[model samples]
Structures are given as structure tokens and as C-alpha cells.
Target chain A: MKKKLTQFTAYFIIWLLLTWSLHFQEVMVGIVVALIATALTRDLFPDEMIKFLNPVRLLWAIFYILYLIFYIILANFDVAYRVLNPSLPIAPGIVKVKTGLKSELAKTFLANSITLTPGTLTVEVVEDNYYIHWIYISTEDPKRQKQIIIDRFEWILRRIFE
Target chain B: MSNPVAIFLITVGVIFDLLGCLGLIRLPDVYNRLQAATKSVTLGTCMILFGTFLEFGFTSGGIKALICLIFVLLTSPTAAHALARGSHISGFKLWEGSKMDKLEEDKGK
Candidate 1:
């Protein structure tokens, strides 16, 4: 019951953000739509997702977005430079990096961050390990690879989700 | 529409998009190409949407552009990851110049 209410609230808030109207009719309609949507998708909402409602977590999430955007811009410039270089200097490899994040959501977020930032593309996740297709394999040491890739975002995600 | 900052951002976005496509052709293997293309293209599209938001501040169109930006940011990497995993599992070999294959090695264990 609590989960359903949370889901409904989320849906309704999204509806409000989309419509951005305070009219009573729109509000009533959004409630109805959100209730129906929540009823249909009650089982889809994971229990852990409720952590997102915490204001601290929300603030951390916003900060994480800013952090992510910074890395994304850096990633774009790095790729652009490589693409424009005549020799096309790349040391492509599939390297493994381990994540300390326990929750599925956090792991997914970490993997997505790795894919968007730097020259790494996450190919697969096995247990706690992520198989990353690295455009530039900076070092052969596995510990260093994990440091370069996962450490940057894991602590922040820990704060947001864990 | 007449906003200079918006115009500048949109122009930069288009240039990045062009470079991403060029990467698609020039990179040796599927993974390398995916790396280059997805990174630049996602950033490009987001920048273009952000420019739209700046051009039409707080209006319905601007809000929609912002929402679209968020959706693109969330989905593009997921799609790229899925494609990379699918291609690798389907026996698409990495390029000859590749250094290591930890995924294949893991399979042997």
C-alpha cells in the first residue's frame, strides 16, 4: 500500500511537471491518470527506489547530474580530439572493473556513467564486475583500472542510493 | 530564435554531431566506433535541446526540450551498452589491433 502511494505520487508529480498548470480540472485529471498508471505498474517499482524521496538523496542526485555533465563534456572533447587526429591513436581493449555498489540501481547508474564518461563503454556486467570496452587502456594493472573508472562515481552514488 | 547564445550552442552541437559521424566511419571496430559516436552524439543532442531551452525560457516548448534532454541522457548510454553487449555476444570479433579481451577470458573461467 505504501509503495503504491509512493508510485502514485511520483506519477502525479511527473504529470504536473509536464502540464505545469494549476487549474483544478488539470489537477483532478492528473490524479486520476496517475492513480491508474500506478495501479497498473505497482509491481514494477522496486522497494529500494523509495530512497530517492529523501531530500538529501535528491540533492545528491542533482549534484551527481552536474558532475556527470562535466565528465560528459570532457568525454566529448576527448573523443573529438581522437577522431580528428590523423593517426587515430587508440588502444582498444575489454578490461574488467569491479564496483562496490550493492544496489541494482546504483550499479546501473555507475555503468551508464562509465559509458558516457571517458573512453569507456560498458559491454557487460557479471556479478560485481563490469566488462568495459576501453578505447584507451591506460594501464595493465586491474586495481588502477578500477580506480580510474569506478572510483570517481561510486562514492557519490553511494551517498545518493546506498 | 534570435538568441545569439542559443545559435552558438546549436552550431556547436551540430559540429559535434558531424564529428561523431566521422568517428563512426574512421574507427577500426564496432566498439571503438560506438564509443566515439555515442559520446559525441549524445552530448550534441543534449546541447541542442539545452539551446532550445535557453532560447524559449520557461515556456512549454522550453520545458519539453528540457525533459527531452533528460530522456536522451538516460536512454542513449543504455542503448549503446545494449548494442555493444549484443554484438559481442553474437561473435563480432574485436579489431586485430585490440589489446585485451577480458570478457572472453572471463568466459573461460
Candidate 2:
């Protein structure tokens, strides 16, 4: 019964968010038709983790979205500074770092985060470690670079999901 | 709380961020730069966000900043680690300064 309620709420809230985005007459009619279709197909699956009942978590997700916007700005500035420099000033290299995450979701989130950040690209990650490619490498001590991301980003991830 | 305190936090955060950026520019290899950028930016961002919180009080922006601060701290390193390990597994060349390519040998086995 609870699952059914959650599923219904998910469909309703999803419809609400969709309509909020597209308030056109044709779109609204299409949205209503699509929502009815979704409602009919709802019980075919058991749990999608798509329940909309967790208002706190939803708020947290929205807050995270806002956070992404701010960080992306900072990231853009860093990338621009590198691009605008007199010399092509990039010391690209591949570095390996350790991961302390205990779950796959946490690890995947971390990987996506690295990719999302402009300068550094996530090359590969396996069994609690990462192969990261950075556009530059100013430090002789590899640990210095490793610690910045590890302590800075990965630690925060520990709090949010795991 | 005070203006100086807020400024101090923001400065420190920016310094870390700058250091990270500086490291990326000066570093030799991808692995090396990833080390610098992720660490510096994440920590620096948090510090800056904390300062923003102090300035803005417990409003939506402040709360949002705090949430972002937390997110950066969490995802940045894990991403770095994944990339590094992936590169190692995928046979991307490591730096000349690297003391060990043990992962390479392990992969071979």
C-alpha cells in the first residue's frame, strides 16, 4: 500500500514538474495525455527508487543543483585562465589516486564529478582507485595533487550518499 | 562572523584553489594535474562557501552554498581516484617521476 502511494506521488509530482517547465496549451494537453499513460503503467514495476515522498531529499537535490551552477562558474574561470595564457600552458599527465568509498554509487558519483569538472578528465577507475588526467602538473610531489581532490571532493561525497 | 574572519576564510580558500590551479598548469602529467586541481578546488570551494555562509546568514543562498560545499568535498576525490585507476587499468602512461608502475604489473597478472 505504501509503495503504491509512493508510486502515485512520483507520477503526480513528475507531472507537476513537467507542467511547471512547459506551460503551453498543446504541451499541457500532451503532458496530460502522457501522464495518464504513465499512471496506467505504474504498477508494472515494484520499486524504481523514484518515490517522490522524500521531500527533504528532494530539497537537498535542488540545493545540489544550485551548487553545481556556482561551481561550474568557478570551473569555467579556471579553464578560461588556462586558455588565455601566453603559452599554451598545459602540462598534461595521468595520475593515479586512491578511493575510500565503500559503495559503487558513491564511486560512480565521484567519477561523474571528475568528468563534470572541466580541466581534469576521469580516465578510468577500478577497485577503489582512479586514473585521472589533468591538463597540467605543477607539483613534483604527487600527493599534493591527490590530496586536494581526495580531501576536498571525495570526503564531501562520503556525507551525501554513503 | 566578523568581516576580517570572513575575509580570512575566503582568502585561504582562494589560495588553495589558486595553488591547485598553479599545480595543474605546472605539473607534468594528467595523473599529476588531477591530483592538484581536484584537491585544491574542492577544499578551496568549501572554504569560500563557508565564508559566504557567514556573510549571508542562514538564508537559502547560504544553505545552498553549504550544500554545494559538501558536494564538492565528496565527489571530487572519488572522481580523481576513479580516473587514475582507470588510466592505470587502461594502460595510459604514468609520469617519469613515478616510483612504481606496480598496477601495470598487477594488471598483466
Candidate 3:
């Protein structure tokens, strides 16, 4: 019951933000939709919404998003440079790297981040190991590759999710 | 829009989108092309949506643009991963100059 309420509240807030209207009719409609949606997807949410609702975790998550945006911009420039260079410098290959993030959500977040970043696309995730297709095959050592890929984002995500 | 910042952002977004298209044409293989399309196009579309948000402020259109931005951020990489995995599973070979195929090795193990 509590989980359903939390889910409804979250959905309602998103609806309010998207609608951005204070009209009573709209608010009522949003409440109805949120309730129905929450009822349908109750099992979809993890049991503990408390972790996500923590103010400190929320703040860290925001900062991590901003940092991710900065990294993405840098990645775009790097990809653009490599693509346009006359030499077409690239060493494309798949390399395996490991992540310590235990939760499924955290692992998904890491994989998505890897794929979004330039020069690295996560081709597969087998257990804790991710097979990433890197545009530049800088090193064959898995530990070094883990440092290159997972280390940058994993620490911050660990705090947010774990 | 008359907003200079919005116009500039849209311009940069278009340029990045073009560069991604160029990469699709020039890159050697399916994997490389997927990288270009996923990274560049996602960033480009996000920028364009952000520009729209800035131009419209907190109005309905602006909020919709923000929603679209979030949708793009969440879905593009998933699509790319599916494509990459599908290609690899179907035994599509990497370019001749490629270095490793850890998946093949893992399968053999």
C-alpha cells in the first residue's frame, strides 16, 4: 500500500511538471491517471523508494548528471576529431571490463553511460563483466581497461545506488 | 526564435548531426557506424530539444521538449546496444584491422 502511494505520488508529480497547469480539472485528471498507472506498475518499482528519496542521494544524482553532460560534450568533440582526421585514426575492437556495482539498476546505468559516451559502446554484459566496443583499443589489459571505462562513473554511481 | 543562444544551440546541433551522418558513411563497419549514430545523434537531438526548451521557457511546448529530451537520453543507447548485440550474435565480422573479439573467445570457453 505504501509502495503504491509512493509510486502514485512520483507519477503525479511528473504529470504536474509536464502539464505545468494549476487548473483543478487538470490536477484531478492527473491524480486519476497517476493512480491507475501506479496500480498497473506497482511491481515495477523496487521495494525501497526511500533510497531514491533521500535528499543527499538526490543531490548527488543531480551532480552526477551534470558531470555526465560535461563528459558527453567532451566525447562528442573527440568523436568528431577522430572522424574528420585525414588519417582516420581508429582501432576498433571489443574488450571485456568488470564493474563492482552489484545492483541491476546500477549496472544498467553504467552500461548506458558507456554506450552514450563517444568511442565506447557496450556490446554485451555477462554477469559483472561488460564487453565494450571501444573505438580506440588503447590497452588489452582488463584491469587497465576497467580503469579507463568503469572507474570514471562507477564510484559516483556507487554512492547514488549502492 | 529570436533568442541568440537558442539559435546558436540549434546550429551546433545541426552541425553535430551532419558530422554523425558523415561518420555513418565513412566508418568501416556496423559497430563503428553504430557508435557514431548513437553518440553524435543523441547529443545533437538533446541539444536541439534543450534549445527548444530555452526558447519557449516553462510553457507547454517547453515542457514537452524537456520530456522528449529525457526520452531520447533513456532510449538511444538501449537501441544502440540492441543493434550491436544483434549484429555480433549474427556473426557479423569486425573490420580486418580490428583487434579483438572477446565475445567469440567467451563463447569458446
Best of the candidates, DockQ: 1
TM-score of each: 0.95, 0.49, 0.96
Which parts of model 1 are misplaced by more than 4 Å? Answer: none
Please state the error at residue B70 of candidate 1 in Å: 0.7
Q: State the lDDT of candidate 1 residue by residue for B1-109, as single tens digits.
A: 7999999999999999999999999999999999988999999999999999999988778888998998999999999999999999999999999999999988878
As a whole number from 0 to 100, the lDDT of residue A64 in candidate 3 is: 88
Per-residue lDDT of candidate 2, residues A1-162 (tens digit): 666556655555545443444457746675566557667877574453443246654565566556655655566566556644667566665557788887666677667666546566676666887765666655646588677555556755565555
Could you report the DockQ of all the candidates, in the order they appear? 0.83, 0.08, 0.80
Ranking by TM-score: 3, 1, 2
For model 2 chain A, the run of ten residues with the poorest summed lDDT: A45-54
Chain A, candidate 2, TM-score of 0.66
User: What is the lDDT, from 0 to 100, of the residue B46 in candidate 2?
Assistant: 83
Off by over 4 Å in 2: A1-12, A19-63, A140-142, B1-109
Considering summed lDDT, which 10 consecutive residues are worst modelled in model 3 chain B? B100-109
Query: Whole-model Cα lDDT per candidate?
Result: 0.93, 0.64, 0.90
